[model samples]
Target: MEVRLTREQVLALAPDAASSKAGAGLATDGKWGLLGADAEALWGECQGSGSKPYQTQVDLAGLVSRCSCPSRKFPCKHGLALLLLYAAGNPRCVPGTRPAWVDEWMQGRRDRAARKEAAAEAAANAPPPDPQVQAAAAAKREASRWSKMEAGAGELQRWIADQFRQGLANLGNGFEQDAQRMSARMVDAQAPGLAALLDHAVSGGGRDLPSLARLGERLGLLQLLTQAVPRVESFSAARQADLRAALGWPVDRETVLREGEALQDAWFVQGQQLIEHPGNLTERRVWLHGVASGRAALLQDYSHGGRGWDQQWRTGYSHSGTVHFHAGTVPLRAVASEVQGGTASAVPADDTFDVAAQACADNPWLPQVPMRLSAVTVAHDGQRCWLQHGEGTLALQLAPMPGWSLMAFAGGHPLCLMGEWDGQVLHPLSAWNAQGEQWERSSA
Candidate 1:
């Protein structure tokens, strides 16, 4: 498959081509030679400010892998920006053999494909098990899990009681180690629900004295499960499911990965934080904002047991852009601001909440505001903001001062959608809606 981009389109996409080329930053005439007639489908390369160039080849037929950048954002910005440059007739070098960097990438792809094929082959060749045999084995395992859960819950309850008796001076004051140890045990006991609970012991996620009584009541239930198996049995099937779910007892990974109902828009990368526990499950939060809708969204991609996100995702403040992304089963939280806008005027007053909004603040450390995640549709909404296009939105209320317009997405769910009655098309803002016990973010 061949990809083509008109010269003018490239220029619009790559505002830096003229300046970069005029500065003689690249090989003369080679840019166009590489672009050729079907430049859009060609491979892309990246040369850092002072580093050697790294090349990436994309399979035009499949829009699949073949890049040197260590980013996992499918068809990352580098890929899109490269195409944009070609469309502008400013490609700086003629396409040629894969560079050493590109070669490494090719080999990596081959290795991954080989592993996948091997795994599939192994599964296919596995001996079939009798259904009854499997069922009986499963029952025995279930019985063992219940026994383990009872012991774990009983121990956890006693631990909480001891802490309370010692006087909850500082649930978080210096319990990081304790919290971590307990959470790890909880995970082992199939109570991943308890790990975050342990984290909350100090994070203020516990809701403070204001909600302490309510929290105690919740804990009391877990404590009861310690000594009495019958009490655990008393819990309704629904309640049992809830308890197990909170325990993080292995839900269908496929379901968590489903991510239904999406919209394509420019998701702002607002703030980011990485979390790791003793067991080493790593979670990354790459928040986003839509420029047109001025809505906020979150891009949460996690890895576990010593693994991490493919890359440290970037946040951006921008003119406007779009991309393809999926919504999670639950909405993630985020802080949305412009990629390069001036410092934020102020964060929200609520200091206790993890999800809060702020004005755009282009932290001076980054090169420029990150680019759009994917191609986006532009709507002339009267409001001055950008957001994910589907269930979420970004309605930026640009203030008079040179500051940022920001919104918060709690648990990544849009509590309310802010839409603008554009002179023509109505556009979306931030979305904050509830879905079951989880929240969702919009890629749509």
Candidate 2:
């Protein structure tokens, strides 16, 4: 436990305090801490003699419980001292003593953790998945994705049949346009499924039996997409988003981004979601952060094809700030539900569709988790480089390799794959799509 520091020791450790002698202490209500010019709250508990003065700490999100000590737990005095030291510009953090109060709390946490371990061990020893139950979930996911894909395939097939009945002369040209639309739709279907279709369509002249087999497979996939609706309620919200993407549902992110592109304006982060297809593919997302008004806009790149690709993307969720779309040096910015359009809402609600398992039954609550992706550069040889994201990075022979997506970060290191970066911590971007149940951590 940390020794109680005298007021003098606290001030001595604070180099930024304009005056070394502190005013009477109770601003923190018995918690002796220091406030800095930068507004970070820091308090010191005295440590061993005088060799070490004060132990400072900064806030880390999503891990700590709230501190009800009158101080905003967000940047309590502990955090202030941390900022003071950090602001001094040295990146190192020193180990310091924990006061009695904090120590007591830590002990209680350890006890609870031990209890949790016992409970988990008990759960692990339980029986295997009821084959019936496992079958049910897998069946549900497959059925769902297959349904939509079947419908899309049927619709496309009908269109093709109609063209054939009309005649084959202009069929090729019509097929070209149709293929382009289908290609975009495939992208919406979360990539892997789309890739399968593309491979099928491009590999054959339609009369080849192999191509025909692929066509049938695409139809089967469409069926899976169609059936996913009923199963949406059965899976977690996040899985539902992924299943939807697998089924080819549109995220409409491209719409928001395109408007930002045309006007070169800022967008709000309304919502974010991620989905995993059957293959090595995974998606990332960020809800576009929003802005209310004014007129300044960021410029962007124009595709020679003229058709904008924004509508296809789902909104991204994390991140804040303004970005110049077309500018090269600046990394990137985010999405929008333009508050200027009137509503200046903070943290947009998750819009990804949720098809939970028979909400008709008692089950667990599952929500979609937004996918985070970063484009990183990969080095094949000392001299060669390729920008990789998603599965590409996973397939690489790099060191420690990379993590799955921006959604998972480890000790300041990026965890996910995104195409396009050759590895210089570039602006990470995501495809914003929705899927369901297929990636549900638990069916229940």
Candidate 3:
């Protein structure tokens, strides 16, 4: 069967606004030399300013795109335009056999995937390592790393104290450089989590009052982490894991799958958010809600360069799976295995502020708490957007485009909204109308 995709979905795959606009402009038939698609892939050649046209192809199975253009961006304008044409059901994208170039690329991908699968199978079938020997080596490594992190934490504590003594007003001139230097030091000290905290503290330049306050808050958290690192052994197993994670130590995925907490349920994909960081790194957070257990889980994935995600989880769909959660005082991040697509189920939006407050009380370091509110209507007060539910209102951290999209979808009526609450602001990711139709903020 031919691959089918909506125009919104095609646009969502664009790497940036410029790419989206350029792809849209190139979607017409006259802009291309040849365009065709089969069940497995689409191929096209777009005439650019160069002497020859650029060959672009897309694998329908994975939505992977490749173009013979020099652009580092994945799904370059030509590839995106090709997909857009196909999505629009343009007559030019008629069914055709795969060309030699497209067939070669697809075969290479299949070969690589097969090799990876074989390696995984071989490893799984291999003999188990000696438990005693493995344990001794692991313990030794952990102890050495702990020593370095503890010393680093002490140094950071002193640095924070020096800042307070010098007064926030004196943090001028080269303060940002100093912070960056300190962050690098934390990385050398094998405490990348601390390094990340330091980076966040100074990210705003410390010029505005709000930025200064955020810096102070981050510093306070760093201080708390410093104090806890030395006494981590005294905490419970789950608390120790939480503390270690805060200190930049994380359990491996295999370990989590083998020993961490696991819950099997029908999980509804509530929404997702993609955050782009420096160095072309992208972080994706997919939120899921359990239908029977009424628990929320977060699936985090990362991609660098132009590589895409390993899997696509559509909003408003259900998947039956076993989610293995990382060990923590309040386990939220998880890995889903044995997942199979299922019919979408209605997510009861009955959560309240008390639920979020309780989560915060349980885990002070928690950055975002998932919330689903029913009968919530979008409201704007000239400058900012708000989500009004019953007698209470919460500020929304939404861009103008998405805010307008949400307003248009809601049409002044109440809807069920799913979002991440970061103590103060609610960043909406999806909303469902009375008819159960979903409007995803990511598509905006």
Candidate 4:
């Protein structure tokens, strides 16, 4: 039997808000007719103003949508409506053979996918370019970038010195604009990390001495980068990548794939969060814990202009997969290469608070370390809540509702809790009691 998707999953595939709304409006039986679904395909016809009904088909395996409607959207409203009806188990969508149109569309998609895979395989097996030529070209590119970055850094240092000479008190009137202008120069210097830092600094209210001190710290960091860029290769691969990332440089996907540590394990999804950034971009962060390896990895996905993500990682699920680690960081962050189907299950809390502290000890810049606290109880005093795990008690950074929810879920008993421990605070993600049932606590 084919797996059914939830209405939320179906709507998440829509390209934009307007498409989702339109698809929702067309989900009723009156708007759709002749609905049929097989193991491989789901097809339906929707009545529109035109004489002939619009044909819609969904490739179940790929979850690709096709519609004969005049809309330019990838999955037109008709396709979304068809999937909605099918997902809802509407009787109108009875089991049947796929029509010729649906079969033909599916065939085309399969062919294209096959071709893409073949091309990728061929490219991977191809021989490398001449070593001498490659070396010379790389050297030239590096020299050019070095010159640009050096000039940008020099200009930034001068600007910082000027700010210091003029004093922080006198720079309030146009400080924001000044920072933005300097940031733009950094961007022109191809130092995106520095630009982002400046933007971040200015975005925070630059109205006080503390803010000015923060700006000074940023300048100090940039000064370090100016010294580091020339001899980047001297650092470890992972550290080099981190530095480049900090400098707003991109890592080549192919390079990482070819030269990275591979770990195969049953990874449990701890939790996932979606954040919206400026310029209408969405950032998705998925945290995973390797059951056997006891390793934590983070997978990041980004979508632009209201488009949805390519893949979905549900919280509280576990799956077998191979994750490739980027060189040079501890408490590793990785990119998933292959993931088999996942099953909904309770995530085991095996590691302890000391594990988090050790990770932070290794990498002080690490913002969050995964920790599992066993024999832990929520301690609330009507004003604040804290988690008493093992020998240590730590305060939780949660609002009233989530804190109360945790208390209710624990119910005065010691439960195993899983969450990230930033050096100072514990951000609970999920928890499970002795019976292995998940303790439903909303993320704060």
Ranking by TM-score: 3, 4, 1, 2
- Alpha carbon lDDT at 5, candidate 1: 49
Regions of model 2 farther than 4 Å from truth: 1-122, 152-444
Identify the superior model by TM-score, candidate 3 or candidate 4: 3
Give the Cα RMSD of candidate 2: 23.3
> How does candidate 1 fare on TM-score?
0.49
Candidate 3 local lDDT, 41-143, one digit each (tens): 8999999999999999999988999888866555678888999999988887778887899999889889999999999999899999999999999999999
lDDT of each: 0.42, 0.36, 0.83, 0.74
- Candidate 2 lDDT score relative to the true structure: 0.36
Query: Can you tell me which runs of candidate 4 are displaced by over 4 Å?
Result: 1-58, 64-89, 94-128, 157-171, 206-227, 230-238, 305-311, 351-444
Candidate 3 lDDT (Cα, whole model)? 0.83
TM-score of 4: 0.68
TM-score of each prediction = 0.49, 0.22, 0.81, 0.68
Against the true structure, candidate 1 has what lDDT? 0.42
Model 1, 1-444: lDDT tens digits are: 222545343223221222223323332333322332133235654564436454545544333434455443334445545555544456343455654544565566569879999999998999988999999998998888877766677677778788678765445655557756876787787655566555554344454675565455444544543444437477665445444544556544343345323344444344443445455455555545554554445544565433223323332223233333222222232222222322212111111111121111211111112112111222224445344444345333333221121233233333333222211222232232343111112222
RMSD, every candidate, angstroms:
13.8, 23.3, 4.7, 7.1
Q: List the residue pairs that clash in candidate 3.
A: none
Range of the 10 consecutive residues with the lowest summed lDDT in candidate 3: 305-314
